[model samples]
Target: MIEFATHRNKDPRLSFRVLDMTVKNEENLKRVFTDTELNPGFDKVFSFACLMWTSDHEQCLENIFKLLRSGGQTLVWFMGYNDLSIVYKEILEMKKWMAYLKDEPILKYAYHDSMDVKSDCYNLMKKIGFQDIISDCERKHFKDYVDIYDFKVHECMDPYVNKLPQHLQREYLDDVITVIDRHIKNDGLTFDLIILLASKP
Candidate 1:
């Protein structure tokens, strides 16, 4: 995404900095920073399909707010709901998998089990001092079926699979794939996307 943004940027006025939020620092870039460190601050922040991977939604949102200049806005999009969440929850209940995944907080998506996601997010942003907040959850159905290989790679289930011995990795994956297969509907996957638009006041 950073590469694409860099290639497409034509304006000399715009500059970009990167932070790998999963780590404290990648070489010299920080995983977290303050607006004061940016001199004044950034005019906007955009998080796309990234926050779903974060375990701390509140702190992440707060960080985004702190990154922006006053009146600067932000747009964040993430997976609010997915069938794989259900699959993971079910798999976690299995005795064999439980031993490996017991300490894992596998549901990284914010409010994945919320009865009222929008309201919950709105309240969070409002409490964070953001103005003109808009939080919505929309369900989308993709045309193509989920490929097993792609699912294994993109779903980030390695943390669970890697805990077992190398010889048992394939067996564990097969078990997970079985659970995933049961959730596939009409040869496609449906996702609930959470879209948030807010401004730092």
Candidate 2:
């Protein structure tokens, strides 16, 4: 994602740095910044699909706070729970596959639970001393069946599909693709995407 962004913006003033380390390590985080004070040295921090992997969401927010200059902002985007009316049929189809792959650990890791902190994002930012906190939930409705089918397969199934037996991987992927294709044609899927924008005080 960063690579794509940097490639599109070639101006030297627009610098992009990719850190290969986790935010849990404060020491490693400090190495990325020149300043050692409470406020490190960035005007803005953007987190996309990263918080879900972090073990400590609040700590991660704190670390980001430490890196931002006073009044700097952080923008976060993450997935939230699906709208039952729109996703119920799709969920039923997914459950069938999940039951068949119940023994797979990756399946459990990928689908059994959500790592997203969608419900707590606003409160977490407030607790971390962010001001002017604003959060919005947008329901995305896909007009094209292929678009949503592709999204579900890639975002929700790919991780688990990679862990299937070599011979079964293709079969599993094909099965999911078929299921999504069928279900989506009947009723287009809708899901909520949450965005949080907050400023460090």
Candidate 3:
């Protein structure tokens, strides 16, 4: 994705730098772009399908605000809710998997289960000092069969599978397939995709 973005850049004045939002520390965050040619403060920022992986939304947004120059805008896209997360949450509660996944508390689909996700996100952004924040959640319906194989290799499932013994890994994946099969409604899944557009003061 980074390579594609860089290749499509036709303007010499605009440059792209990568920040590891997963990193929570100031030093590690600085280390990523310390030697880059771009000066401090970006005019725009973007995050695609990335915020769900972050454990700290406040810190993440704060970092983005800090990276941007005054009046800089940002667009963030991420999953809102889906049956896949329900399947994963069920798997987390399974007796056999509990011991292996005891340390895992935060779900990748973190705020999706909330009763009012938009308001929650809006409040967070407001607290972070972003202006003109818009948090929109769109519910999308799918008609295709659930790809059991693809999700088994997904990052959301990998953490749980990685913690299990190699012998139990395949079985766990099979169990996930079983649970997913139970939740599939007419061979399709509904999803909520959140689009957040905001700007720094």
Candidate 4:
């Protein structure tokens, strides 16, 4: 939650500090960074770190290197774009997809852009100056992961079949209604989520 001040530039309390998140919460990001009394060097920053989709990995690593005592550990987590289409296709089968689509328009646009950015998580991390890239597929071997569904149908199917033609959109969507019916019963599955863990070593 970011509180906006109309005259933030003149605020005396405004300052910056680097922080690491050990837990999943990020509502306090602006607060942690803007505290005047904080210093990444003096504070025992998070030993376990997490990187989110919005975090700049380079800045995170740089802060860890500069502020953390040597041998201090930071864990960064980020989302990967590889096979994002297929993964989203699977997620559409889940109940959460509808609620998400109602609020997110850029997600579909980003999905379109991802087609050409073939650098999977590992490759992109390496390009950004990370080392010790490790791609882990172990989660696929376990059942704890959420089941996936063919969500791409929602993204591309409309343009694929409609293309400004209203009749065509309805025709395609109606046919999908049948497939969706069976899917709701757990009969549909799609996509692979590859988890890659990279390090600074």
Task: Please identify which of the two predictions, 2 or 3, would achieve the higher TM-score against the true structure.
Answer: 3
lDDT of the structure predicted as candidate 3: 0.76
Summarize candidate 1's per-residue lDDT along 134-153 as a digit string, tens digits. Answer: 99998887645456456556
Clashing pairs in 3: none
Q: What is the TM-score of each candidate against the true structure?
A: 0.68, 0.60, 0.72, 0.33
Clash tally, candidates in order: 0, 0, 0, 8
Q: Give per-residue lDDT, candidate 4, residue 8.
A: 50
Lowest summed lDDT across 10 adjacent residues in model 3 is found at: 150-159
lDDT of residue 17 for candidate 2: 70
- Please report the candidate that would top TM-score against the real structure: 3
Report the error of model 4 at residue 118, Å.
Answer: 9.8
Q: Write the per-residue lDDT of candidate 3 for residues 72-139, one digit (tens) a residue.
A: 89999877787677777888998888888877874657576689989988998999899999998888
Candidate 4 has an lDDT of 0.39
Better of 2 and 4 by lDDT: 2
Shift in Å, residue 159, candidate 3: 5.3
lDDT (0 to 1) per candidate: 0.74, 0.61, 0.76, 0.39
Which parts of model 4 have CA positions greater than 4 angstroms off? 1-30, 33-103, 106-119, 137-184
Worst 10 residues of 2 by lDDT: 105-114
TM-score of 4: 0.33
Q: Candidate 1 lDDT (Cα, whole model)? A: 0.74
Better of 3 and 4 by lDDT: 3
Which pairs clash inside model 1? none
